[model samples]
Target: MITIKVPCSSANIGPGFDVVGLSLSIWLTLQVNIVTTTTTTDTTPPPHTLNCNITYEGEGASHVPLAADANLITRTALYVLKCHGQRTFPRTTHVHIVNPIPLGRGLGSSGAAVVAGVLLANSVSKLGLSKDRMMDYCLMIERHPDNVMAAMMGGFVGSYLRELDPADMERKEIPLAEVLPEPAGGINTGLRPPEPPLGIGHYIKFGWAKEVKAVAIIPDFEVSTATAREVLPEVYSKKDMACLSPITGTSGIFNLQRLAVLTTALTRSPPDAELIFQAMQDKVHQPYRKHLIPGLPEILASVTPQSHPGLLGICLSGAGPTILALATHNFEHIAEMIMARFKQEGITCRYELLEPAYEGAQVIES
Candidate 1:
């Protein structure tokens, strides 16, 4: 049997929404084995027949459909095998899955499933699929390459979609070309353990700064990707863009030179109090998205960088609800302060500090 473990991910940090993503240490494991017989009693139709069995564990276990053909991971794995010229199955492949990533929480649970499928097929079939090729198929399946890139690459990945050449397709005559990223970005990331207690009335914050503690704040709420996309406006005015000048720069030329420097410092070196505070400025996207998340701006305003002594920058995880903060080594003190600040704002939320996962997905024999 081939066993693979895939990490969970978070996408879209402030201005880089749908573009930036980070893979976390959290993981889901899949075990697949080839079953040569359909019946244990030796009453099978033929010697070359195949049968399959599936088992699931952890989060989403109750929700995952039992139909193997309809299961996303199973279907994708089967598809990968077929694409590699294995049109027929002589033996059934039994699959067992263990998952922990939260679904539909902007945590990239679906991305993990897609990644596992691709990896499982390649390993079981001995296809020798390169990481790039696997990522290509996964990106195609995800409909968003950012999350997949982070999942595959296992760090902070920044990616943006660009139009593909229609002429290339015209020459080959293919329809529905894929959406992909020109490049990707990421850094080793993590979440604080002692897994924070889940309850209402907790404090939450989001955005950038020096010396930041990334508390991955999540709520007991479900928000669909479609719903979140629908809430975004189609256009913004010149005046509206003008409002971001101070945060962007004095000239507001759209060059967040200081902000980029801050990000570079944190990734190049280990995240510290100075780096977190330095990275805490967002002149873009946050204003536009504030309407979607009401408590965000208030949280940002409430957490004074140096005044808090240990807090640095704060930013949202993927979509809505999950907030991450960058902080100093003295996170406990700042965490308490953060709770107090959010309470005063009348915004109750929960948080967990996360670390970056340096390794991507992997499969091991059992």
Candidate 2:
């Protein structure tokens, strides 16, 4: 049996939006066991039998569509199997998914499933696909490369788009280069790069694993991506742009200044209440997306005032009703305090203290 354990991920840590993501240890584990086909002169069940059973558990099992052809993860695996030239399903394969990740709340639950699908296919087929290639396939399926990278590579990753160079592919002979192809042809053709392309992509590492513990507070309601995108204005006046200069200036958020801001904020306060609260400031996305998140003001005000000294930063997790607060170390007391603060607001929320997962997604034999 091939068991694929994929980490859950949270993207857009405040200002990063689509460009930044972090993975948590909590995972959705998928176990697939291939059933034996016919034996020599003996009657054995045939592989790919229509009677093969697929089961899902944990987070969204009931809601996840049951038909193998309709299931997202199953479909993804099938795609890979087809790519590997496997026309038939393995006989009586039993598939199980244990999910801890929440869906559509900006915690990357979907990305985990996509990753799970690709990894499961690779393992079952024994197709020795390279990690980079597998990552590319997963990312293409996910469409959010940064989050996919975090789900695949683990830990904290910062992504920025760059033109794909054709020379990079002369060695691999990848038929499609727009994703990682010759820069000139792909760029000229206006063909967008595929989601979740190969390599770790253009990314950088920040902070240590033990040094970070993230607190994710998810509100009850869901927000549509379209609505959140609409909240972003298409244009801003030069004066409004000028007003943003300081935040966008040499020490702007787009740079390491954002992290510096958090570090500085935490350093100044008593390390209990003041420092951590001050560190949550954002000049970029939060201020804009707040409109979409109900009770955000109350949630923010509550968490900020009761901040723990160990806290590094706090910001929206994607287009969120989910908020992520990061810390320099384990802060159980602080976490309880924060959770209490939110609970008092009567918001339906759950919190988990998680470290940066650096291993990404992988298969475990069961």
Candidate 3:
């Protein structure tokens, strides 16, 4: 039996906007039991001929798919196996997944699922791949470094996709549908999937203040990432990119300046509440996403260092119906205030105070 545990993550992190992420304490765990059958008679079935059984519980269990071909975790595992020239599980595999991370609320549920899948493939096939190598497979599926990188590496992290060579660039463009296919029967064994280019992503882990904790103010609704992104403008005006000019900067430079400061600001011993509160402000995604999340603007404006002393900063978590607030103390007060603002908009919410998970993903065999 092999056990894999992957942590949930919060991406964007205010001004970082698809560039930074923090791994949280919540987790998605996968327990695998591969049964090996001894051949006694001619009628004994071969390992590849047996099917995988998947069972899921917690969080999205009510709606999550159980079939190996359809589940994201299983599909991802199959993609890796196919890319490595191993077409199927070597034995009858039983995988049971336990997830506590909320799905589609910008909490990196999908990213965690993808990480678990890659780990599953590595363990089952005895790939002996390094964490970096496993990350290559993960990046191929998620296509973004922010959420997936943090979930895999743990702690606070900043990541970027590498510029591939022309030949590999074409390979990178392969459609996601082809990457993780859902055939009516099972994974397509006829055509080999495009293997991820080696070293497709590079990342650095950042330091996080031990005192600073995350308060997740999650609403009782889902905001798909696609819908949140649809509201953003493709191009920015001079005003949006302007910084330190006579006129005020709006978006681009606004995020850049803050993001530069925030990466280090969070590592200081005595965190600066006021500085962090300002640093966490965004001009990239959150402002545009306000319309999708009711009371978003109000909560960001009303909750502050002056109003809530222990509060350091607050921002929309990922694409968000969940608001993440960084604070030192007075967690309940901060949560209540944010929840009250959401309540005014006729939205109900719950809160969780989480610490960063220092260790990324873990695997155990017995």
Candidate 4:
């Protein structure tokens, strides 16, 4: 039996888009066992038989597939086993899942599942695979590393999808290909790699400033990642790329200034309160996504540097609906302000104060 505990995460982080993510304290737990159901007590055949039973406890418990074949954890575990050269997929396996992290809510529940599967595979097989290797498989599964990177490594992570040498790969991002399965001739036959080299490199580039608190201004309504993605235009216009004129002596480029301040907030040790608010502004996804979240404009309008003291920045978390904010103090006030605005506009929502999870997924039992 093996148990995996993976922290939930938030991706995008304003201008970082798919490149940045931060892990929160919330978690998803998974327990997997290789055993047979009581109905088939016979130790009959040479073939190892396994029965699968899955249970969910929170969040998407009622909706996530209970059947092993349809479950994300089960499928991912099977794939990892196959990649590790398992002659046959497990026919009798038991899975018990507890998901506190909300699903399809820009809270990284999928990333948690991916990390859970890979880590479960590593533990059950006693394959001393490193976290870096696990992240590789997770990246292959997601095609992006923002959520998985934070879930796997924790802290404030920044990543890029590109090629790099082994050493550089290790430093720039978690190496997914750390352990490759090879057959008789030593030529690897299993684990079909991604068609394109979607190698992602990431690390904890910075930390939050001031006595920071991450607040999730989550709404009652849900927004599917697919819908949010579909709403975005496929291309950008010249105006979108246009930077501020050189005339202002560096004042013209809006997002660049924001990115700089955001980076400073992260890189600097004690986070700079001066930079937090500006850092949270975005030019990429929010403009197009505002329509999906009810009362977003009102919520933004309600809070400002003058109106809400200590409030850093507030913006979309990953896609839509949930608006994550940063603040040095007055958490309850911020929450109340956001909640009041939503209520007045007739938008139902909830808020959660989150802290950065400094560590990634771990094995609680083996």
> Model 3 TM-score?
0.94
Give the top-scoring candidate (lDDT).
3
lDDT at 264, model 4: 66
Looking at model 2, which ten-residue stretch has the lowest summed lDDT?
181-190
Off by over 4 Å in 3: 38-50, 244-252
lDDT of 1 at 44: 45
- In model 2, the runs with Cα more than 4 Å from the true position are 39-52, 165-200, 224-227, 235-256, 259-280, 305-307, 328-346
Alpha-carbon RMSD to native, per candidate: 11.0, 7.4, 2.3, 6.0
**Candidate 3 C-alpha lDDT tens digits along 1-366:** 999999999999899998999999998999999877744454655433225788889998899988777788988888888888887776678999999999889899999999999999999999888999999999888988999999999999999998899989888777887788655555454257878889999999999888999999989999998898899889977666545645543344788889999999999979999899999988888889999999899899999999999999999999998999999999999999999889999999999999998898889999
Which one wins by lDDT: 1 or 4? 4
TM-score of each: 0.74, 0.75, 0.94, 0.83
The lDDT values for all models are 0.59, 0.64, 0.88, 0.71
* lDDT at position 101, candidate 4: 82
* Candidate 4 C-alpha lDDT tens digits along 74-146: 5565456666666333445566798888777788888888888888777766668788766767766676788
Clash count for each candidate, listed in order shown:
45, 11, 0, 12
The most accurate candidate by TM-score is: 3
TM-score of 2: 0.75
What's the residue-level lDDT of 23 in candidate 1? 75
Residues 209-244 of candidate 2: C-alpha lDDT, one tens digit per residue? 344567876666677655777887677544323234
